[model samples]
Structure formats: C-alpha cells, structure tokens
Target: MLNKLMHSPSHKSILRLLRNSMASTTPMAHLLHDTARQHWRLLMLYLLFVLLLSFSEACLFATIYQTMRLLLGAPSFTEIAGFGFTQGQRLFLLLFLISALQMVASMSRAIAGILSGRFAASCQRSILPEIHRYILSLSYGCVSSFKIGDLSHQATLAPLTINTEIDERIRLLTEGLLALIYSLVLFVISPWLLLMAGFLGFCIILTQSWLRPRIRLAALAVEQQRRNISGTITADLQVLRLIHTNACQEDSNRRFANEVEVFDQKLKKLSNLRSLLEPIAELLPVLAAVLLGTVSWILSDQQNGLLIPGLATFVLALQRLNIRLAKLALSLNALTENQPRVEILNQLLTPSGKIFRRQGGTPFSGLKEAIVFKNVSFRYSSRQEETLTSISFTIPRHGMVALVGPSGSGKSTLSDLLIGLLSPTFGAILVDGKDLQTLDLSSWQNSLGVVSQDVLLIHDTIAANIAFGSPVVPSPEAIRHAATAANADGFINRLPQGYDTMIGEHGHRLSGGQRQRISLARAMLRNPEVLVLDEATSALDSHSESAVHAALDSFSHGRTVLAIAHRLSSIRHADTILVIDAGKILERGTHDELIAARGAYADLWERQVHGLSRPHLHKQL
Candidate 1:
C-alpha cells in the first residue's frame, strides 16, 4: 500500500512542485538533482530508513497512549470476545510492542547515519573533479580576469559548499517527512487541535518568508567582502618584496585592517539574521500548544474520561512535530545562506558564462618549413585600439629572427601569438602551409620552449624547477647539463644542498639574475624545436649575459630562435631583425643592413650605445 501511494499521481505532483520551487529560488537545486541522480540507489535506501523510523515513532506513541489510559483507570480498548486476555497480559503485549519499535528505530537511525556519510563522500568524489575540469577548460583570457585567490576559493571552497547544501537539503526533507507523519497522527486524535497547529505553522512560514530575502542579501555581501579580502592578501603576498623595499608596511596594515572591519560587519549582520530564525520557529509552536490547552479547558465539561489519554497523546505528538519543524527551519536558513556561493559556482561551471578556447582534431608532430604570420591583427577585449596591426613575419626552421621595439610596442604580444596563447583577430598564422588553428594546440605548444621577462618558478628543489614540464623525468646528468648551458650550475653547486635546495615561492630566495638563469635552464631542459626568448637575459649582469649569449650561439646551430630584445647588442648577430613601433613594423632587415640604412633601428641603436634617455628616443622615433 505504501509503495502504491508513493507511485501515485499526487506524490509525483508534490515532487514536481518541490523541484520547481527549488529551481526558481536557488541555482543549487540543479546541482543537487544531478548529484542525486548519480547516487539514486543510496538515496532511495536512505529515504526508506527515514520512513521506517517515522513509523516506529508513531507505533511507540500508540503504546504510550495505551499505557497512559491503563494507568489513569480508563478503559480505552475494546475487549476481544474470543481471546479474553487479562489486563496483565495486555500490559505485557504493549511492553513487547514498544521494545520492538524502539529496536527498529535505533537500527534505522544507525543505517541512516552511515548512508548520509557515504552519500556526502560520493558527492565530493564526483563534484570536485568536475569543478576542477571546468576551471581548466576555461580560456586563458577568461581565467586571467579572475584573481588567483578568487579562483582558488572557487576550486577549493565552492565544491565543499555544494556538499553542505546537499546535507542541509537532506535534513530538510527528513524533518519535513517526520513532521508530516506526526501531524497525521495528531489529526487522527484531535482534528480541531491540529487545525490550530496548522495556523501557527502558517504564521511561522510568513515570518521566515519576510526574513529570508534580508538574510540572502546579507550573505551575498559577506561573500563578496570575503573574496575581496582574499584577493587583497594574494596581491600583497605576490609583491611582498616591493612592500618591504618601499617601507609601506604601516599603510598596508591600515588598509588590510579596514577591509577586515568591513568583512566583520557584514558577517555579523548575516549571523544576526540567521539567529532570528530559530527562536521564532521555537516560540510559535509553544504558543499553538498553549492555545490548544486553553480551548480544551473551556470545553472540559463536554469531555469524557477517555479525553484525558487522547489529549495527552495529542500534546506529545505535537511536541515531536514542533521539534521537526524547528529543525526544518534551521535547514532552510542554512540553504539560503549558501545560495550565493552556489550561484557563483554555477557561473563558473556553466559554459555560457565563460569563453572557451577553440580546439582542433589534427595533431601537430613538428614544424617542417616555417611559422608564417600573414596580415595578423590583434586587439584585447578591454581595449579599443589594436595591439598588433597588419603584422607579417615568418620564423623559418633552423633560422634566427629577432624583434626590437620600445616598451608596449607589441613585442610580447607577438611572442604570445607565436606561443598560441592568443589568436589573431583578423589574419591567419600558417604552419608548414597549413593554418595554425587546424593543428592541435597542445601538441604545438609542447614542441616549443618559452622564456619570458617574468620568470615562472615553482617553490621546489632547484632540479625540480629546471625539469618542471619535461615529458619524461630527466636524469641528474641531463639536469646538470641544462643548468650548465644556462650558466646556473655554478651558483646551484655553491649552495649547501646543491640541486636539492628548496627555492622559495617565485624563487624569492634567489637573486634576479639567478632566477632568470633558472628559467633559462627550464627552457633548455625541453630541447625544443623552436625557442622563444622575450628579454630572457634582462636581469643578468654583463658577464653572465655574455656567457649566456655564447651558450645560445652554440645552442642555436640547428634550431629556430625567435628573440625579442630591447638591448640592441643582444640581437646584433641575428639573421633577420624587425623594428616595431606603435603596433607597426617600421623596418625589417639584417641588423647591419638596418644600421647601414640609418632608419629607426639605427637611431634606437645609437641612443642605446650612447646611454640616451627614453624620452629623447621616443621623440626621435
């Protein structure tokens, strides 16, 4: 009968109503539904246990009612003619039923606890990986918009919030079911009293409805403030050296304190709103009980002896129902509080909210002929002007090319295009007569090595940093060879721990030159087909730079090198040189040829050679 009732149309309608309501109010509802579908069998078994517990509690209450009647000298049960049982036998039967109900309730409670834990674990196992995968799938441009701290919070905290939301929803459902059962039992005993309780429940619902919007607003404010504090801390840590050098510790502290104060104020406001829910939920039920008792007292003259036990059973059922109602209220409050986090997470997971890189099916083995940038034009989304305009260049296989330009003259942007980090807005980049977009990006990128002005080093052993992205783990000899070629081996060997010494975050423990050398070593370990160096030796002193240049002269014998340099002396021996200014290529030829031509490149070289200031050079250009 219970199974049939569950499969009935009314039951399906109730479920649909619940789903629609949750979907309209919070984005977490869809996540919860997906998680439920993944673990439906466990969820069904858990619900079954909850139902059994509710039935056991009702049976226990029935036994209590009979015991109360017998103790009050009231004959509530009809005597069966055939069995003819004595009062003592009846008492023994009630005791046996109560014991059986208690035992069933205890077992069901334990099983429910175990199932809830397993379900939570299952959710974490599935949801966390999905979150991470989505975050990784986002395009570089999209990811750059988010602060590291904010993104970290999304990856780490948002998935946990989903699990918490699931737990709260489960609790809400369990309490709601238990409350419904208790209400039915109460209604069977006294319909008028049940009506009074329903009215009080309606009042509580209205009060919650008024408070919920305010709570949600406060919770959103708290979440924003918290992420702001996280972003501020992350930015400060990344520039800790700058802060120390400038002696801005006091100002930084004052700013951080102000942020914390705002965060605390918002948090307290949210807490106060949530705290208001419990007392109101608890108080309304008590008032309903009082009203019921007053009505019963006024009608005492019309009641019989059986009324005493019936009334006692009804009040007991109402009290249990009130407990469940209070718990349900708290669960609802928790769900509302976490709704903002769920919305943010949903935005991250949803494809419409992000830009994804376009991928192709063809795998890139190796570049054979050349990388041709034909009429390439590029612009950032935030900027109206083009960063690279009508740029045409070719990086031939096993040939050396260099780009020279003023600051913000699209040199790094060109390297970024070559690295496949940005796509051209107008023209095509061809690889071996095929469109660069037609080949697999990961394969293309894996075959190239890049060393930028800002060196990227992880907090690990020196050897680990050098061999960070190698396809296979490098042997100790190979690591030493790469470090030696980059002129990093001497300082590394001088350290007490040699290659095993731990570098602090971003290699903060190392000097600027040392960090740059380590970065070069990382690139050297790859033995790439095409090497891109954007001011790769800017941090190195003259002696180290000369040594690295000699090493590169040997390394560049059979490899393609695209070098972007500001120091004219570094690229004077290149096979081809391009001078760029204001997103346009002003001159392209050999360095000596450009010097002989006495164009922009020669003018810039003259200024650098005589140590002229940039303001004068900009004017001359």
Candidate 2:
C-alpha cells in the first residue's frame, strides 16, 4: 500500500511533503492538526458547543421568519402541529421560545470561548518552553549563527503571536462551519437567492485566492524587514556611546530612519492590498442582500397566496447567510496575513537533520591526562580558506599554556576547538586517549570554565549571574569565596546591596575591571578542571590586573589552563607559549625559552616590550 502510494503522482507529492515535514520543520497544517489532536477531548467539547450555537442560530432565524409571516396575515400555510391558538398567539409563544434558545446559544458560545482560550494558553505554555529548551540545546555554532534580535523575536514574541493566530484560525473555522449550516437553511428557503449569494461568496473567495501570493510575498518581506529593523535598533542602542563620542549621532540616526522608512513603505503596500480585499469581501455581500431582497419582493408579487410569508423567510435567511460568508472571508484574510510569522516560527522550532545539534555520546569525566589536537584543521562553511591548519598540539593536564597571536591568526578558533565549541574538520581532538566526539560534550562543558573579553551578565542579582549555569545556586559563602579569589569581593562588598546588587544589562552598571573580575569569579565558582582565559584581564588597570593575576595563580595550581592573550606581561610565567601565525603554530616554548630562541614569539615579545603594536604581519620578521 505504501509502495503504491509512492508510485502514484498525487500521492507522491503528498509523500514528498510528509518526508520534508519529517526531515525539517513541520508545516503549519501539521502543527495545527497535531495541537488539535493533543487536546482532542477539549476540542471536541468546544465543537459541540459551536454546533449547538449554530443550531440555535438557525432555529432563531427560522422562528423570526415564521413570526413575520404570521403577523403579516398570510395565514395557515405551514401551521405548527397540535397548536390550536390563533396566528397572533402562536407567533408570540414561538418568538418567546426562540429568544430563550438564542440566550442558550449565547451561553454555549461563552463556554466554547473559555475552553478555546484555555487550550490556546496551554499551547503557548508547551511551545514557548520547548523552543527555549531547544535553543539552549543547540550547538554553539548554530546558536551564534542567529542574531540576538532574531533569537529574541523567536523565543519571546513568536510564541504569543502564533498562539493568538491559532486561536483566531480556530474561531474562524467554527464560524465557517456555522455559516455553512446557515447557507443550507437559506437554500431551503429560496434556492435561486441562495445560489446567487453563493456565487458572490465564491467571487469573494476567488479574489482572496488571487491576492494570496502577493499578500504572502508582502508578509515575507515585512517579516524580513522586521528582523532587520530589530537588529538595527539593537545595534544602534549598543553603540550609542561610541556614536556619541565620535560625533556621528546624525549619521547613525539617518541610517536607522532609512531602515524605518523602508519598513513603513512595505507596510503601506501590505495594508493597501489588505484594504482592497476587505471592501471587495464586504461590497459583494451587500450587493447579494440587495439583489436577494429585490428578487424576493418581485417573486412575492408574482405568487398570490402566502407571498408575504415566503418573501419574509427568504430575506431573513439571506441576511444571515451574508453575515456568515463575510466572516469566513475575513478569517481567511487573517490567516494569510500571519503566514510569514508562522513560517519564521516554524523554521526556528523545526528540527532538521542538517541543523540539529549533536547529542548522545559517552559520558565524560574531568580530564585526567591531556587534550591533544592531532593534525586538526577547520574551515567554515561560508569561507574558502581554512581557519585552522594541521594545528597539532597537546595541552598537558594541570599545565598553563598561553596562545599568543594577532587577530585573525586562529587563536580564538583554536580556543573554540579546546572548548569543544567547534569540531575539527580534518582531524581528531583526543581527551584522555579517547576522541572528543566520543565524549559527552555537555558533561565536558560542565567540567570546563571560561573567562572571555566580553562578559555576559543578565539583568539580575550579581549572585545569580555568577552562578548562572550551575544546577544548584551557589551559597553566599561560596559566592564570596569565588569573588575573593577573583579579586572582586572588595568592590562587591562596597556596593549598596553588596552580593545582592542588581547588575544592569550585561553588567553595564559595573566598571570594566569590576565586570572582568566578576566574570573571573563566575569561572572560579565552577571549580572547573580545565579553564580557558581569552584576554580575560585586558580590561583591567595595572593594580587590578596584578590582584587578578595573584588570584589566578592560586586557582591555576592543579587546573589545566589555556590562556590566549596579547599582553606579553600577563603570560611571562606560562609553562608553554604557542605563537600561532596564519592558522599554524610557528613556535612553542616557555616564555623565557621562546625569547632566547628569537623566533615569532620573540618578535611579538620585543614589539610588546617596546610598546609597538602591529596586529598581524603576514611575513615573519
């Protein structure tokens, strides 16, 4: 049966789509369908209410039409069985019963709203946390590939937007079903009028269909523009101090304004198309009502007996039918409008073979012997040049190794390899005689610590930021001890709130030296077996650097330390110094030995000693 389906053209297309959905992100239809299936009992209950509401609406409209007929004095056409009352009394009682039924229908609708709202909230609760967890689980490369703005939108805003859209679509679906029932009743009243109204509805649908591609394109454009705008706004805010210092605020403002203008233009185009759709959806329905009423009156004149009653029924039914069709059209428009955002969310949430983060390897313990890079090479997917080339080296257990090189010479790339952030493209990294690939990275990471140039702190208490990744929050004494080791406790104690002081965004409230020390304290808090320091103290003043170095000396006694720095003063006591140039280690020796040898490391040392700075000389001096 599966083979036959695969061979059939129509089934092949469906199979291909299913395969695509499985391999990549699920399509919107599948997402909705899956969500509905998860809440099947509640959805079914909601639908029952919707059905009751629709039935009540049909009954009430029919009752009104009957009441009009009896009051207009067209008697005895289709009398209620066993009711012996006069037409006036019959009409009054019937209207009263229909009014009560209408109230019941309203109450049912209210109940359905509660159920749907709860279901929608549940969907949000499920999807938001899941997406956040998935993001955290992604490989460092995958995480870094997305911008902060884009990730923020995906994690924070997209779930809410998607849930709201889901609610709207579900509501629309129920309304559409209700409209169908109304259309059926109208068809029974006057087939000709019903057919004409359906023709108008079909035209409305056709117009929306024609506008779909354009609107969808516009939606995509707007979504992209929104990301760009978000990125721009974020970038501008982050660089505001630099812009002001350089006296380029006008230039920055103009650039941001231009982006905003472009976004505005795109929005205008989208709105124009949307507005065009609305009037067309609305106008045709009104025309249908006018034409149907006119036809009913003319038909009433041609038919002598019971004409008023029939005409009244047809007119009321047509009115109800028009309402349902109009609502259906609007629902479709809303779905189309939200397509781009949904697609963006789908891409973020989708787990694809090509993009999935690697998982499930042998659990790793702390490094016992050494981390060895054997003939390691790496090239980014977007670049032709290899960033690291045959970078063979061994970081001995419980040793301090300094990587000294200019920018773009693969110091950070090599560090990334050491941290298991990037895997070797053409070689293997071994830890304790086992391939890094075989070791559980998460476990390995837990045993590792890092202090980099840019320290990231959340807008929370200092203690929280220092104890960010630990499964359990560090105790106050532990926090104080780590801070003392990092030479940060003195200043932390001086703060208004002491250890409980709230750090502003990225610890902007603190000085550069303070932030760096706090970062060091964070690294120390983990008591990592392996520590990587990439220009960790470059922001510190001389006194602060000395204090931090003293703290690090105590911490580095038994830990494997991989330090990357340009300041020759800091690594004077390193056990081993590797001087890298153009993706290869040209020299490796102790600080004193490399100086005596007068090689690449020697040249860098001399330059730093003389306060001469040359970033990267392609040719050896």
Candidate 3:
C-alpha cells in the first residue's frame, strides 16, 4: 500500500532535495508516505520484534490488574503474611520485574537502532554521491537557478534534518505502537472504562486536525528562512572585502543582522505555539476521567455499583492510554513538517531527465585531436534571454585560440558548453570530430584542464591542490614538478612544510596570486589535451600576472588552448582571436586584422586602452 501510494502520479515527484516539503505536497502525509516507502524492510523487522515484545508487555500489564484484584479479595493470613513480601512488596517485585523487562527491551532496541542507523547512513552515503552527480550533471541552465551556498546547505545542512527525522520516526514508532496496543487492551478489559477515553479521543482528534495546517505552515516558514539564510551569508562573505573597501560594512552587517533576527523570531514563535498546545493536550485525559467519575458516583452506590474502584482503576488506565494516543497523533505532524525536506532528498536521489553522457566521441585518449563546436546556442533556465546564440567554432589541434568579448558576451557560456557543464539549447559540440553528446561525459571531462576566475582549494596540503584535477592523482614528486611548472614552486618551498603545507578553507591563508598559481598547477597535473583559461590574469598585479603568464607559456605548449582574455594585450599573440558581440562571433582573425576592421573588437580594445589612459573615455564603451 505504501509503495503504491509513493509511486502514484499524483504524488509530487521527489526532487533531488530543495526544501522541507517537496516543491509540491502537504508535509505530514508526505513524510509518513515517504517513510513507509524508504524503510519498509526496517519497519517490517521492527514490527515483528515489537509484536513479540507486546505479548510480554501485555502479560506485565495484565498481571498488575490481577494482583490488585487478589489484594481486594481479602484472602486469609497466609496470603497476606509479610514473611517474603507484603501486599505492597509483592506488587513492587512485579513492578521491578517489569522495569527489568523494559531494560532488556531497551538493550535490544539499541542494537536494532544501531543496525538501522548504519543502514540509513549507508543508503545516504550511496545516495549522496548520486545527488552530487545529479547536480553536476544538470544542464548549466538548470544549475544557474541555484546558488552554490544554498545547494551546499541543502546537500549538507538540510539532510541532517532528515537524519534526525529518521531516528525520531523509529523512536516515535515504538512509543506509538506500544501505547496503541496497551490502550486497546485496556478498552477490551473494560468497555465502560473506555467511555471516558472517547471524550479525550474526540478532543485529541479535533486539536490534531487544526494544528496540522498550522504546523505545516510553520515548517514551511522555517524551511524558507533556512534556504534564504545560506544565500544571504554566502553573498555577504563573498563580498566581505568589497564591503570594507566601499565602506558599506555597516549596511551589510545590518542586513545580515536583520536576516538572523527574523529567523530567530520565527523559530521562537513556532516553539511557543507548540508549548502552548501542550497543556490542552494534557488536560484531555484528566477532563474525561473527571466526567466519568462524576457520572459513576450519581449513577450507582459504591458498595454494589457497576462502576466500582476496580473499574475506576481500569478507566484511569484507559485515560492514560488515550492521552498517549493523543501524543502520538501530535507527533505525526512532525513527519508532515519534514515531508518537503524528504521529498527534496528523494528528488535528489531520483533519476533525472538530464543525463551527462557524451555523444559520438572518442575519449580524449592522449590528446590526439581538437575540441569542436558545431552550431551551439544556450540560455539559462531562470533567465529569459539566451546567453549564446547559434555559433560554431573549433579549437585547432594543439593550438592556442583566444575568445575576446565585452562582459556577458558569451565567453564563459561557450566554455561551459564545451565542458558539457551546459547543453546547447539547439546544437552540438564534438571532440575529435565525434559528437561530445555521445561520449562518456565524466570520463571525457576528466581529461580537460580548466582554470577560471574562481580559485577553490580545500583545507589540505599544497601537494593536494596541485594534483586535484587528474583522475589518478600524481605522486609527491609529480605534484612538486607540476607546481614548479606553474611558478608556484617559489612560495610553496618557502612555507614551513614546503609542498605538504595546508591551505585553509578557500585558500584564505594564501595571496590571490598564490591561490591562482596553485589552481593552475592542479590543471597542469591533469595533463589534459584541452586547456581553458578564463580570465586567469584579470585580478593579478603586473608582477604576478607576468609570472602566471610565463607559467601558462610552459603549460600551453603541445595543447589546445581556449583563452577567455579580459585584458586584450594578453591574447594579442594567440594563434586566432574570435571577437564576440551579442552572443555571435563578429570578427575572426589575428589581433591586427580585428584592429584593422575597427569593429566591436577595435571598439573594446580602443576603450580599454584609451579609457584607462584618461578617465573621460571610460564611459564611452
């Protein structure tokens, strides 16, 4: 039944995770449904074990009731004699045995829980990489709609919520099942006792229904805040330096503060609401018991009554059970609240329409041929406009080709398309005269060497950074050699640990130039056929720029180079310069040829040189 419901077309497709509930679904029903689907084997095993234990639990409950009855019967002195145990002592011993049984139950539960935990974690481990691969596999158009920070939080942060929920579901399931069984037994023992419980049940059911919508709304609020929080922090941290440089630190701080404050307030409100509801929940059983006692008193005499003390004790048991059932009903909302998050995780785990396989291509296989683009066009999914129009170009075999353009003129878009990071809205790219769409994308891309404006380095050794791109990481000696080629050897050698030194998160300890060099070294270690350098020197000082450029000269030899040059001077010596304007190649030739034509290329070049030379021409471009 659970599997059938989960697979139904009406159920929202699980997203590769996005938020609390999936993009579509009510949380409680979704979580319960999803949990049933996700952990069927565990649930079945747990249920079987619980059923065995319930028999034991029922024996314990039934024994207490019978023992009290024996005491009330007022037997002879032999039964009442306190030699081994008094009346209280006998009952206490039974209670102690029940407590011992619970302890045994707890131990077994721990072992079972550990097994379940390992299973879920293993499933998650297998699923996480697939999630990552899905994100990596998405069309750049689809990916651009997401922020790396938010995705990071979702992939790492939000999934932690699911982990907690998994544990809670187990905890609640046991408690709920035991309570349910115990309550049903109480009702069976004395139906008159259940009369009071019905009132409590009515109250519990009414409250649970009302709170479902509200709890879901609160969960939705919490999820929204969490998603936005990561993005806000990401943006602030990225431009931290700019904040100080422009003296906008105060304003940025205020924005961050506001975001956090709002987040805290929402959390507090949700907490307060849950707390306020607790008393009402507790009073349900008490009110039902009081009503039954009042009616029982008026309806019959105590000495010869249908509702006697024994019956009242039974009613009290049922009342407790009713309250427990009420608690279980309330907890079911948490599952709902967690539904969106689970859907997102499920969606992430779900197979996608976007497949990254390469088409009609030979593997880069020792750099035998050039990278080719037949006719290519691309637009971001979120953005209304196309970033690259129908354009065709090829990087010659082992030759340097430069792409020159004004900002947002499709240079980055082309590089992304060539890398299989984005698919063409309308055309194809080829590697070695074979359609790239037909080849093994990850395997093919594994052979590419790309260096971009963003320099990402992990918290690891300099050696690790230098050998990051290659499928088979180089040895220590190999890492040093690659570093030497990138002109990163000097600074690396100066560090206390030499090649073994760690670079903190974002390579924060290193200078910008140092970080860029390390990134370049990593690419060199890969020893790829296709080399792409996108604005490699755009942020460097002249001295650093020259050093990196010198390193590039060594690296580019015997490789096909695609350079997206920000400073026109850098690409002047390139084998071919493609001047791009409005997502199309406006001019193609040597730098001097483009200069002679005096088209967009000449306009941009003239503006760069003339604008920097004097302030007046800067606005002209």
- Best prediction by lDDT: 1
Candidate 3 local lDDT, residue 578: 89
User: Which lDDT tens digits does candidate 1 get at residues 26-111?
Assistant: 34555555565566678778878988998898888888788777667666352433356677877777788879998998999899
In angstroms, the error of model 3 at 441 is: 1.5
Predicted candidate 2 versus true structure: per-residue lDDT over 473-589, tens digit per residue: 789889889989999989998999998999888788999899988899999999999999999999999999998988888898899999999897888888888898789988898
Model 3, 182-219: lDDT tens per residue?
66665765566565566567777788788777776777
After TM-score superposition, the amount by which residue 153's alpha carbon in candidate 3 deviates from its true location, in angstroms, is 2.9
Question: How well does model 1 score by local distance difference test?
Answer: 0.82
Between the candidate structures 2 and 3, which one is better when assessed by lDDT?
A: 2
- Superposed model 3: Cα runs more than 4 Å off: 1-49, 74-134, 157-176, 297-309, 343-362, 366-370, 540-551, 595-621
Q: List TM-scores for all candidates, in order.
A: 0.91, 0.90, 0.81
What TM value does model 3 have?
A: 0.81
Tell me model 2's lDDT, rounded to 2 decimals.
0.77
Better of 1 and 3 by lDDT: 1
Residue 56 C-alpha lDDT in model 1: 94
